[model samples]
Target: MAYDSIEDLLNNGGLKPGDVVSQRELMEKTGATLGAVREAIPRLEAEGLLITLPKRGLMVPSLDITFVRDAYQMRTMIEMTSVPFAIKHISKSVIAGWIDWHNSAIDHLDRGDEEVAQRLQRLDWDIHLQMVSAIGNALITNVYRVTSIKTRMVGQSRIRVTPANASRVIGEHLAFLNPLYAGDEVEATKALCQHIDNSLTLALGGTL
Candidate 1:
């Protein structure tokens, strides 16, 4: 229940920066028990996603320059760390599966499906999270999970949703994947770095 509440915020964008929420409100919203919500608070606090107010209790963290920079820096570090492990350990089958999945998603988007938004959301997580997880390092995977909490928050709050933005995201991911698919280390390094550079720029208020 505790974890679900945080995921709700991540997946649904239920709360905004500066929004104040109480445990009781969370209970009403997510059907989580008071005890579960209580247990969850500390973890959220530890992630710096929320802060305690002396009189107001908990407040969602407002977006800030430092947080944006720190978030992207962490993302870059995670991507760099994962790349070698991913290159060394990611199986051919996994790479092919990812290509099929993403291409299928593009097809569905072209078909004007009602679930395109949710499907795209799933793809975003599948790609980003799976990229790190594929490295097969528990410590790296765990660290990435913590970083993901902030990235999701900032991304949902900042990234513009439009046809152009969508195309850019697809292009960048494919650029990164193509080299990896072909087992080209030098090209993969360039693509991976380019992806992070563009991503950091987008997170820094640049248009896609």
Candidate 2:
């Protein structure tokens, strides 16, 4: 939190697909001590944000098509099924907050920096999870919180945030929201399905 590992990557768009980074480089850039860098690496590694080589230094994890597929499979299962429960329990204010976060991500869609856009997309997903938590279903929310990191690890690879993809994602968010706003559980579930399926497809080819 103190250092600028993720923030640096987001701010300057320094990280890229298949880019490898060593402790020395991280230290130089982040101005973090070796211990701090060491501690941070594992956290990122756990999130699939970092990868290690046998004799090589730490690098960005490679994306795999299988990982993408499976991650989406799990995500779709969790999110789609959670829709009815979320619709029942989530509050209007929470839904509004999600919409605002989704719109903020859309505003950055044309930033021309793919990495920054991807970071925003990831943050948007984070906000969505928070919204889901408002459903007050501890079991479902806990499962989602655990699986989401895996999904992020794989999904982050394919999120390029072009106008088209950004628009599509934003639209899906609306699709999920409209029904929720109307208190229509069925429509909300349908929208959730489309969103999860589309996310999986997008990530399948672009991982790593």
Model 1 Cα lDDT, one tens digit per residue, 89-207:
78778877766766666755565554654655566666677778877877877777766666656767456334335555666677877778787767776887887787667767786
Displacement of residue 130 (Cα, Å) in model 2 is 1.7
What's the CA error at residue 13 for candidate 2, in Å?
7.0
Please list the C-alpha lDDT of all candidates, in the order they appear: 0.70, 0.66
Q: Give the TM-score of candidate 2.
A: 0.68
- What residue runs in model 1 are displaced by over 4 Å at the alpha carbon? 111-114, 134-139, 160-164
What root-mean-square deviation over C-alphas does model 1 reach?
Answer: 2.5
Instruction: For residues 16-115, write the lDDT of model 2, one tens digit per residue.
Output: 4467778878877777787888888776667456677767787765556676677667767767666766776777777777677667766566655466
What lDDT is obtained when candidate 1 is compared to the true structure? 0.70
TM-score of 1: 0.84
User: What is the lDDT for 42 in model 2?
Assistant: 71
**Model 1, residue 33: C-alpha shift (Å):** 1.5
Can you give the TM-score per candidate against the true fold?
A: 0.84, 0.68
Identify the candidate with maximal TM-score: 1
Clashes of each: 0, 1
